[model samples]
Target: MSDQGSSTSTSQTDGDFEGELDEEVESEEGVKEKGRDSPTPSLSNFSASLRAVIRIKQKYQAMKKRRQEMVLGLGAGALVGAPGRTSPKIFTFDGLTPSAFPTLSSIQQKKKKRRRKRVLFPTGGGRKAMPRQERSRATYCLYLLLAILFLQVYNAIENLDDHVLRYDLEGLDKMLRREVFGQQGAVDGLLSHLKDYLSTYVHNKPLVVSLHGPSGVGKSHLGRLLAGHFRSVVGETLVLQYYVLHHCPQEANALECARNLSSHISEMVERAEEEEKIPLFIFDEAEHMHKEILDELWQLVASKQSNEYLNTIYLFLSNLGHGHITKHMLHNSSSISMAMTASGRHSNLLKELTPILRNTLEKLHPLWTEADILPLSLLEKRHVMECFLDEMTREGFYPDHTNIERLAGEIDYYPGAEGREYSQTGCKQVVAKVNLL
Candidate 1:
């Protein structure tokens, strides 16, 4: 009975230990359930939850801000007004809110605001930047002005035809008529032929003419006139004139004159032909030079064998055949008259006198007289009076015809010359007489 009581007590102790363990376990379960249901949790657990939420919110805010910054950077990079941009875009920030994320237009506006406040100098200046369009236009205009200046410099260097300050062809002819008297037909013939000759040197033949007439005539005057009028046709140093009386030293005989002439002619011809220019040689007083000079002269004209001299124009003036010329004019005295436009007896004079003059020249110098015979006729009373009146007009003064005739009476002429009483000295003394008047 003692053993059974001992066993029963042991069983009751085990039951009690089990029952306490179960109550403890049940209490722990109830506390866990209460903590899960209650608003106030453990301090450490509440703090851990709060830290996790704060970390997540910070990550999300950082991501959003980064995305906004990327958009702003993109907008700024895309649009800046610069030259050579084909497609232009304008950005605006009208209704954008400040707190909102930065948009493309708003970011662009911010960039522009910063730029406006920024310095501009060599970067920009004391004033606002000059507009890009205005700057570009100014650059282009400056370039154009430089180009024009360069072109002007080139033209000035070339110096084409403007070297001749005066180009007056017709004015020359009128002046010739005013200065010379009683030879309009001869002067007109010279002008017509010279125009054709000078322009086309290689086309036909050069003009070779000999002035055959009386003394005190205008042969030397005409030669000088030609040289002065066409001054621009050649270089200033190209004119060559030979007066027989002015040949080297008074002792130079015909042979010396011939030698000097041929040598000088050859050199001048070479220069003129090489440069493709027309040179003028006026040989005056063939009658005075020895027969040998005449022969050299004839060879120069007739054969023209010197290729160098082919382009030169030769004018030989002399009183060689005036005796025949005077007889012919006196023979045609009844028909002789002077008109401004009419060739009159002067036109027929060449045909009749050419044969006579050619025969005389041919006999005198062993050469074929291949030349244009220009006979300068005698000055009539009317021509003299007109010349006097024109001279007074040129001197800025005027005089009546009565005074001119009275002054002209101081001159003398042969009486039996078929009423053709041209003065013994022709018009040579008239100038002296006018000075006295």
Candidate 2:
């Protein structure tokens, strides 16, 4: 019974050991399968994470590129649209649209429209009338200024004429008419020349008057009168009465006379220029003057000399044309009387005689060509009688017409036309005859 129990126990123990070995093998296989499956799942998860990161980077790059394109588009639009109206087309960047920038012209037009509306509709209510344009004080002031300027100009012009009148020319005219006799035409011519010259202070050349007639026809008297008048008006220093016989009698003194004459003229003219005055130079018995003296006078008055000589008056009293004057008076005594009454006829008569006188004096010297010739006709009997009466009155003698006639009759007379007698030597001996009284 003990042996059978031992055998069963041994078998049971071996079965138990086999079962434990099978269970260990199964646990090792399960562990190997778990390791292989774990490796595959970890590798797959790593690949998926890498792909997601790459996609995210690509999306960020696309967004940055779109932003750059939008910036470029905005810059281009602003540059292109600056000079003209803003484009009507919409500008888009990555499907985004912004409002258009307003242009300068559009803003100005809107402002103008607002202004027009404000003008059409007054804030007070109804439209107001247009404002009247009142004249400003400035306009009247401008007119007043123009009027004052015009008045000033007019006054200045009047003053220029008044300046000429200041020389007492009317007084000179009256004196000539009162004192000088029987040479109405000559006096007229002389007065006219004086008026024309003295009217202006400016002169281009000296005035030269050549008086031609007989010795006793009042040429020297006229010279004396002119010298006296000018001496009173201008001054004694500015009046030079030169006589060939008195100043230079001898032929040997001709050169010295000429030098003296030139120096005197130069000094006189210079002084007169300083004083702004015109000088008078009278040459009595100019026909008897030497060629050198005449030439000196001519040089002083020549246009090429100097401006100081321009404002001077020179009188040349000569008996060179006395023959022609006598002949003319004898032939035209009746016409001359008529001329004395009519100014036109007197001028015509002077016109006819001037050329003849000029031609006659030109034979003696060429200096007469530059001179304005004035011829004194032979005095009538009545004129000589009047001269005698004037001298007697000047000498404080009784007023006796019969004695004047008797004295005038003593002078030689030339038989003239229409019972008119002309004195051969006009008023020559009247002074002597009066002194005898």
Candidate 3:
């Protein structure tokens, strides 16, 4: 039994050893198979791929930078050339090829064919159908013409110096005081009107701007400023001459006077459109204009009549008192009645009068009276004086306190026709004299 057991154990040991040997062989085979399947890249091939990627990146960057340079250069050149160039075409060498020459030849041949079809002198085969050489020449010629046009336009814009700067809302307080120094009533009324006008303008309403009061109240100055502002927005025109009835010859009848003024106004309107592109009309010293002139002026101001011709933002500087505007319209004259009715306001005087005029002016219920006047009291005049004095000092036009007081006193004592003085003494004339001085 012992011998049998030993023999069996020896047999089992042999089987175990065989199994171990088989397992070792299988593991070795698997390792060899993996080694065969995986191959390593060569240094040369790896380097070549890396170089290719870098080159692509570099190429992209170069192209991006080139595009930027081209755009910037072209824009700069265009801006620099705009002043001297008229034609829209630009001279450039980009995108040219040998094949382009052949295309140009073909274009020339086509143009020749077209010319053969048309016999007119320099009229046939318009610009589009022209030969390549002719087209190039024409383009260059157009450029020259455009250059001339640009030069002319520049000159015209540069020469428009007919504008005068007036006090804007930013400086109104100072301006009012300067004009109405001692006359609080006048200053109050004028400043209020100016404020109203500015407000209306800000609201984009159609304004019939009229400055009406006694003579020497700086109406013309205000009118000119308002006109300049209008011109700045719409355009500008130079009034070379403004001839009144008194300035004309003895033979110039009222009809002739009207015709002459109309002709001047028409020309001015046309020039404003053509040259200055201005749409506003300003009439300074409108009160001094004759009845004939007033009739024509009214026509111009009436939006329905000459608006097409005038394109006017109308401003009338008048010495005609606010009372006349209200009272004169009620007289029942046909012309006055028609003008008042069509004036776009209850009264003809309200047509282009200052917005303050509405509040300051008392309604001339039966006829004109002191009650109907919107008086600028003494306090208002003093305020206005301070405003003007402040502005003048800021503008480097300094005056002594005594001088300012003297000026104010003058406004308190001015004389006028019909025993009608300045709403405050010396206010109007003193301001004018100071400005003149």
Candidate 4:
């Protein structure tokens, strides 16, 4: 009985112990469950993922900003090297980083703004900034001025094809066409001055009219016409003399021979006075006249063979462009007075003239007042055709009126401005074509 009790008690104790162990296991599982349900149980893993995502976003933003900065920097650099910018290339230190471009908060810490350094153009000392339109206009103006200057230089070096003394009065008279053919309006201003001089200078007054212009601009042609016109009017009985003064020796003793020459001139003047025809003196290349010779010529004009012939008309022909003459000789106040041709206010040409010459010109103002010819107006198409017809008739190749009318119509319609609108060449070409037909 005692052994049975002992075994039973032992069995009970073992059963209780196993049950406790199972309960402990269940408690351990419950604790594990509670741990899993805890709010912060996976905090480390969650934190790691969040951190990684944040880092990725930051890297992407940084890369994007860097790319934008690089693009901006490259564009700025390319613009700096462009041609004709005139502005100097600027190397900016700020473009290197995003932080360099300040926010409003950091602006107070920023350094004072510095002015951009000016870049000078190599052609001249200073750099001048011009707008696009102004720059283009300036470029065009420069090219045009250069072209004109080149043409002027070329003409100066070439020999003049026509002589001023070749055109006789008869030819000039026919050319007048102002009253006859109605083309005088083209050159009336030029002629009016001559007419005034003729009327005011007392016919025998030794007149000095300077004709100055650029080479190949018809100064010589005009001079020839003037000389011939005077010759025709005064008759061949009067020795209407034209002289091209040549350079003589510079020595003081050679002046005596010059005086002898002057005496011979005086004799000629006296003889001219004896005749009723006015004695006209035309000096070719008056710009090149020796100073002594000029002085002598002036003396001759002043000298008189009694009251019969008071002064001889003097015409000085020059082919130097108007500016050159004004620059060297026409600065004087007398230049304006002595200018018997132009009646208007002093032009750029008058301002450049010598002051002494200006005063001399003012004395001749009366002659300018007597001018008969005015500014040239455009010639009618019909008148131009008539003149062309007259020349063609003289050639003995009479063009049909229908053909002439057609050519005139074509010329009138051609696009051009004054001086080049109706070309003389076009008319001649028409005549030639008609003759061929």
Candidate 5:
């Protein structure tokens, strides 16, 4: 029985062992089958991986296009981000992507290009545009205007110091003759001295003239003539006429005249030196002017700036010393009565200032008359006739020249004067005389 039991156990043990081994082999097969069923890496898997990678790249490309569109939209221009479109979509991105947009210059260039294309392909042909001749004329006009503007500017700059330092004395004489009638010798002498004085014009060395003559003589007339002629030399002509009886009478007004005269002169001469012109100050009826006024003038003449003020002429017209001059002439009547040759004798008479002149004027301005004091003499018959004709012409009356001699004989002369000689009024009444004719 022991043997039997042991053999049975052995058989069981073997059977169990066989079963276990079979199960083990089956588990191994199952494991191998599972492994085979699962996915295996191959060429097809590689292709599928490449396809995934291509899909990601396409997504990235789309994002870049969106970003570019957003950047173009953000450009600071009204005509920006593709024209004729509004409400453009803004692109979104991951962290802090740098933005870019088109510049104004680029946008302008694009607009210009579009305009050129439109112009080249207009609705009509080139004939529809403005005419070529008119367009060319407009362009030429613009060029000419610019050229004229440039020339005017250039001339203004160049003429800054334009002044007449030297002038034609003979021309001045001719011009004076045309305007001022009779007193040919006086006119000629006045201009000759004036020309010579102006030739040596320096700052303090002014051309001072004391026109001492009879009341009706051409003292004031000659002054006007000088101013007119001076206008030709300087581009501008202005006279500061101080009619002593009119502006500031002698007595109490002389001091007032002195003060006002200084101011007046200063104003006229303020820019005179700068503009390169000599200021003309005419003291008419100068004998009537106070000694104080003369002193004031002397101060101006002696001023340091006076030496710099060139070509300035101070004209003093007066009848103060005429009586003395006439008396002196009467003493030497035979030689001096001849009006034509009276010019040379005038200097000699003035040199020996007659009793009345020496007393009244010598104390006033002793040196004022040291230079040539022009003494306008009485006019003769021939001079009066010429004066009458000139007066007629000035009055716009073209009376016959043949009637001039006959017309002059009718004008009245002084009691001592006869034979068509001038009156005591000289050429003063000549204008009225011609008017009556």
Candidate 6:
């Protein structure tokens, strides 16, 4: 009985399964029929289908986003752990490390070696400083050269004044003092002017000396002495002695005389300049010269003349101021003798007489105004006696003092101040008197 009950139960289960299958088939057919009968879709059915498709697209997008997030998380984890791992070595194109290249390493070593060499030898060979003593010696040599240059300049200045030595001024001074007696004042004035003019080669104008005195007070004698002396010094060709009476007499035409005098002066100056020498011109008896002749002489000695005329000496011996000069000496004999004795006061006597002589000469001709006037005093009785003795000796006679005094007494005298007797004709007649003896 238990076996029977088991089969019935099994059959009933099979019957139930068959009934479920048939119902499912019939329901599918009924749905198809409904689809055929309706023909068009409804609004509700279409909306539901659209809702289902949207939900499916949303789900797909959510899946893709999750996949990307997972991939990024994996990459971040690898980077965070990369620092703990060993770094790979980089290599150049030649497959060698940069520091391992031979050329680069040699270049760096050479640069370091050059730096060391520069530090050790800065000045190319390390030259030492000069010793202190040697430096001082060099400085001393420089100073010695400077001192020698100074001495050379000093010697040059000293030589500049030596030009005056060639004229032999010392001998001239002695000759004037020794030979020209009783005219010490006149001699001094003459020498001073000569020395000043002859000391230099350059001059602005010619030296014009005018000697004024009475006939016998050595006016003509002095002029002759000067002419002779200059002839000896400068040569006879450079010295000219012009006598107004002899060369240009009163009977001669005034214009002819003037022309002759001018030509003579111009010729002399030209010759002297060529020889580089100073020429001397002596004019005796100048008071008798015509106004035309005087004017010609004035033009020659004027400062406006050519430079050749400047280096000349002119002597005008005249008796125009004789009376004024003699009168002055007689009135001031004592004071004049004193002044002649004192060297310092010698110029004072000339200062007093120069104006009187100048005024007398200027009245005759304006040419004398440019002259350096030197007036001679009247000769004393003693001076006249000296003249007598000199002339006696020259004539080859004994210069006896008694004879000299006797001859001097024959000359006229102007009884001067302080019991002084001055000769009127001075030494003018001494020669004639000596001849008589």
User: Highest lDDT: which candidate?
Assistant: 2
The residue-by-residue lDDT of candidate 4 on 1-437, one tens digit each, is: 33343345545655655665566556555655665787656766556556655765665566556655654554455456453334433345753787766788665444333223444445776866564553567889999999999999777544222222232433555565332333242244444444444443244444555554433233454556665666675655443344444434444544664576577666656776666434666666655545456566655555554544464556566543444442332233233343333223224334434343444433533322221211111223665577457656767856578766766666533233322233322233444544564
Measured against the true structure, the TM-scores of the candidates, in listed sequence, are 0.56, 0.66, 0.36, 0.34, 0.53, 0.64
Residues 214-248, model 5: lDDT tens digits:
86667787777666666666545345667878887
Model 4 spans > 4 angstroms off: 1-190, 197-205, 237-257, 302-309, 324-437
lDDT of each: 0.67, 0.77, 0.48, 0.48, 0.64, 0.75
Candidate 5 error regions (>4 Å): 1-166, 235-238, 249-251, 302-306, 309-311, 336-360, 365-371, 398-407, 414-422
- Order the candidate numbers by TM-score, best to worst: 2, 6, 1, 5, 3, 4
On the 0 to 100 scale, the lDDT of residue 342 in model 5 is: 43
Q: Residue 391 deviation, candidate 4, in Å?
A: 12
lDDT of 1 at 323: 82
Where does candidate 3 stray beyond 4 Å?
1-207, 230-253, 274-276, 301-307, 322-384, 387-398, 410-426, 431-437
| Best-performing candidate as measured by TM-score | 2
lDDT for position 25 in model 2: 52
Write candidate 1's Cα lDDT for 35-101 as tens digits: 6898888987666556655754665566556655554454454444423325323245844687777
RMSD to true structure for each model, in Å: 21.0, 22.6, 32.5, 30.5, 24.6, 23.0
Q: Candidate 5 has what TM-score?
A: 0.53
Candidate 2's TM-score = 0.66
lDDT (Cα) of model 2: 0.77
Model 6: residue 255 alpha-carbon error in angstroms: 0.9
**Candidate rank order under lDDT:** 2, 6, 1, 5, 4, 3
Tens-digit lDDT track of model 2 for 213-259: 88788999899988988888789999999988999999999999999
Error of 5 at 145 (Å): 49
Q: Any idea how many clashes model 6 has?
A: 0
Model 3 agreement with the true structure over 144-234: per-residue lDDT tens digits: 9999999998776454322212324445456544443333334344446544543321223223444455543455555554455444444
Error of 5 at 370 (Å): 6.3
